[model samples]
Target: MSASARVIRSAEFQAERAWGALPVAELDGVTVRLHWTDSPYIWHVNDGEEVFVVLDGQVCMKVREQGVEQVHWLQPGDIFHAREGCEHVAHPQGVARVLVVEREGSV
Candidate 1:
């Protein structure tokens, strides 16, 4: 759904992440979708805010710079975000589902 209206599918966004970068769901204010991957670069943020909703999986979201903020082993409905202008990476130990939201800006 829209941020203030109804849901509108974004044709510019379409991706499936198993072991790669997931595209994104339709978005006007924010984006949403499911994703799963094994990586050391899952939550890398750059000049934008990225929110991740974990559906199922073993994942770690951490700043690749500070190394202080860390989110790991998320499950269904778990949500997290990448700091703006901060780089993040997700290390998934097992397969999982994730809904990522990146607003219509630097992402």
Candidate 2:
């Protein structure tokens, strides 16, 4: 068995880029990434489920459900789960640090 640990400074990471993702870990079939964004991402569907966690700032998660678009506001510590085939896009309110967990290369 192998285990690893890391200390991430979210603020530092966010300050480095306006919008970007940093790979943190990969185990089994899941990959963990740290994202810093101040813009909206294009709508897309994940090949598998995705766990989006807000570590800092806010996010407006837009999802297409039942042929309608729904907006979910997320704050720090909030989480939004997107099941497979769920079309969604993320809009950051400002400088937001997000932790994303999903199947490797699902996006």
Local distance difference test values of all predictions, in order: 0.59, 0.90
For model 1 the TM-score comes to 0.60
The residue pairs in collision within model 2 are: none
**Model 2 Cα shift for residue 61 (angstroms):** 0.4
Show model 2 residue runs off by greater than 4 Å. 1-4, 15-18
Could you tell me how far off, in angstroms, the CA of residue 53 lies in candidate 2 after the best superposition?
0.1
lDDT of 1: 0.59
Clashes of each: 8, 0
34-106 in candidate 1: lDDT tens per residue? Answer: 5556444445455678887765665666665666765455666677766677777766765655667776554
